[model samples]
Target: HFGIVRFPQKKNIVFQELNYQYSFSDWIQWSMKIDSDQKTKEEYDKKIILFPEKKQIRQVDEPWFDMLLHKATIIGGEGRLGRNNVIFTLSLAYYSSGYALETCEYNMIEFNERLHEPLSSAELSKIVRSAYSGNYEAASREFIVELCQEWVAPELKNKDLFIQRKGWWKFKKPREQRKYSHKKEWKEDLVAYLSEKSYISKPYLTLSKKDLASELGMPKRTLDKVLKELKEEHKVFYKVTRGRNGGMVIASVKALFGTIIQVRKEMQQAYVAAITEKFGLTGSFVLNTFKQLAAPYKQPEEVRLFTVDTG
Candidate 1:
């Protein structure tokens, strides 16, 4: 008879359950661990099979299984996995008792599933602007890291520690060169960059700080600071319109426009690809694009952060 199996390790008093699909004998039977403790079991299992290679267990791909392993390694490891069963069980029970799922049809639930929501148009714009700012302290990395670290770290000590210990992403852009291109003019460059991305109706010939900086091998951080200084001096204007609060300063309009447009286009494309197959557009590309852009409306607070412009 087929039934769900709940395994309880001695020291790890918590119970780990899995739905087993039985086939003929043990040869074809398959089961997936639902808890994060699977990694612990796997390590132990791997060690057990060292003496007898023929007795090794079959490995299968499952999100839950991976999650379990991730948890075991991250959360617990008082020496070997099963060394302190009681502590493991207590920890598992304490953690699993609080488990809550938004949906039951679970297609491999992620740890941050509860926290993650789509970014709205305004929010996307803000993230882009912040990225342009190049100030790590003021960037959204703090909030993003906090949101993501909760599910993964058992005891995160500090933000810097998390950043250093955990994985972090970096932005890359090419160096700027000035001699070959048209002479740098703030107004002209800003207009050209925006027009290229269809942000503005017409392209002007002036060079923006961002664009010129790119052309002249200026560091992104240095460019952002210079743009801010220029904004204060009335040499550049930071413009913010409806919905998405993007910026175009007189000094760096060209580079800023390029960055914002590229980010929006990439985000839109990713959203489209993710949902297109599930909710078929009937091959209607226009309809699909509209649908993808319509998302990121779930959280207004989050959306507002992205929409706030320097202007």
Candidate 2:
């Protein structure tokens, strides 16, 4: 996404997840998530004759509620879970109608199987069939509310007003996970990474602003600032050669020749750096060391090698 520099303001380029409102099918698909996750839990079951006073621990917990809360609109996509009845049956039934596997398995098992308490097999079969044949929405909210009422216990049925609500999910504001970092921290991480990759004092190689900035999750201007700072120190150099095969490499003869040589051998061809300077082998010792390595290795015609002033 290109930033709006002058003429226009940069509107939010990333998708804001809060805009989404879940539908009945969305509720159903999420509800039907498989309960694979299990861990030991110790709860006091007063009715336990063997250990009424003691806590009992066993693998018994469902991770269904932890699933992603995205709305599913596709009739086919809604019904294609590996297996898990996540939200509630009314929604599950609506989606199951579209699922060939769910509908085709038994007369009315798709929706009925997901229920904690099953309804009448005969009555449910006929009703669900109509929904399967493209009448899912037609299966009114009243039917869903009634289904909830039927499944609940006789004592709890007194809360008829509460039963009016559909599905298992409660109305709570969603929370978005955010990672916090200070500018100082970001600069530190970038410096450390670049230093580690370039072998510090013997710096070599760097990437294009567009590519490296994006890879490092940083702004190009910030990268430029860091690199410019290093260049002013005269510890490194950003050199660009001429001709068709020419390109840029950030290096310095001020750095140890052995260190620079070792980096080329161990590190990647292109380094992730934010340092720059005016570059060349100026020091006699640093220059001769590189010349030694390049000796018996004549410059390739296709690729321009260093200029050695023998005089």
The C-alpha lDDT values of all candidates are 0.34, 0.39
* lDDT by residue (tens digit), candidate 1, 89-112: 222222233322222112112222
Q: What is the lDDT of residue 101 in candidate 1?
A: 25
For candidate 1, the 10 contiguous residues with the lowest summed lDDT are: 78-87
Candidate 2's residue-wise lDDT over 118-222, tens digit each? 445653443344334443332233333333333332233323322233334345433223354444555565555555566544466545555556766777787
TM-score of each: 0.17, 0.23
User: For all candidates, what are the clash counts?
Assistant: 25, 11
> Could you say which candidate leads in TM-score?
2
For model 1, the superposed segments whose C-alpha errors exceed 4 Å read 1-99, 102-162, 166-284, 299-311
Off by more than 4 A, model 2: 1-187, 199-203, 234-236, 240-247, 251-278, 284-311
Residue 278 of model 2: what lDDT?
Answer: 35
Q: For candidate 1, what is the TM-score? A: 0.17
Error of 1 at 23 (Å): 62
